[model samples]
Target: MTDAAARGLWITLEGGDGAGKTTQAGLLESWLRERGREVVRTREPGGTEVGTLIRDIVLHHRGDVAPRAEALLYAADRAHHVATLVRPALARGQVVVQDRYLDSSVAYQGAGRVLDAAEVRELSLWATEGALPDLTVLLDLDPAAARARLDAADKPFDRLEAEREEFHVRVREAFRALADAEPQRFLVLDASRPAADLAAAVRERVTALL
Candidate 1:
């Protein structure tokens, strides 16, 4: 492995909207910090200034954005995010705990938006120059349950969040397919479980990596 690849532990949490990824990322960050680990907690589509602007365009634009354009926007954010924030933090030997990553693009744009998954993934690989997480914790949840959680939150849905249930179902399936394809790199967890329990499971898996 290259020195860049060996720099630090890159961990990402992925799931459909309202799947508890943000909550778990917080817990993991706190847990790691308690153990004296220098942890960088961040998220996709808004990890940097450039990405934050791209995020609003992609998720909160008033009108329609062509599917391909949307995908490319996400790719652009990923490129900047990895180079400016993620890779540098990792190179400093910090545990980078992120709320979302490239897999989200594959699931949301590729599967949910009905684009070519392989092509979308290839675009991201080219964008980030193939930077990948050491581990990706996938919070698996049923689309209906996920929707219910979102509804309970009572917040206006973003563009992707407002997508139909069918879109979210496709996204869920895509996430599972990704986990199955690379079992060693992914830790799939049921999102319906209590948050504490899920955090414990994550802590266990992450401990092994440390």
Candidate 2:
């Protein structure tokens, strides 16, 4: 395969909060680096300086934000993130491991917030120029267990995280549905498993891509 074909492996980790995506992402980054691969690790709504500001407003804002506006905020951040951070890094043949992507918007804004899923996805696709991850790791978990993990963290919940259990349930279901729709691009795993096991599974799948 040519360099362009062999490199620029865009990978994303998606799931509800407290599903251990951050931990697994760290482990995946370290593993890739150990093998002499260039890895760019980032998160949605806060990957770049501009995105960080958006993250605060979207996640930490006290007042209610209209569902459509919230979705737009996420799309704006995604547009900037892909244009500035993700695309450039991938052009240099780096592995872009992202915490969240358009899938989150579709699940959270579409299903949880009762917006149109197709419309939300279409907006993100337009914003990001239809750049899809080569692989998406979905860490599936029960909302109750996810909430328990978050509660143990002892930190204040963010706007989306503060939503009711029913909302999170819808989000989880939407994630699973998305993964099922595109099995070729997604590896759905039970987040209730041991972190090491989850990391191993992620590594195994990613190694094949590498």
Query: Best candidate, lDDT-wise?
Result: 2
> Which 10 successive residues of model 1 have the least lDDT summed?
1-10
lDDT of 1 by residue, 1-210 (tens): 134336878899999999999999999999999999899999999989998999999999999999999999999999999999988888898889998998999999999999999999999999999888989999999999999999999999999999999999999999999999999889999999999999999999999888
Instruction: Show model 2 residue runs off by greater than 4 Å.
Output: 1-6
Off by over 4 Å in 1: 1-6
Worst 10 residues of 2 by lDDT: 1-10
Please give each candidate's TM-score: 0.97, 0.97
Report per-prediction Cα RMSD to one decimal.
Answer: 1.4, 1.6
lDDT of 1 at 23: 96
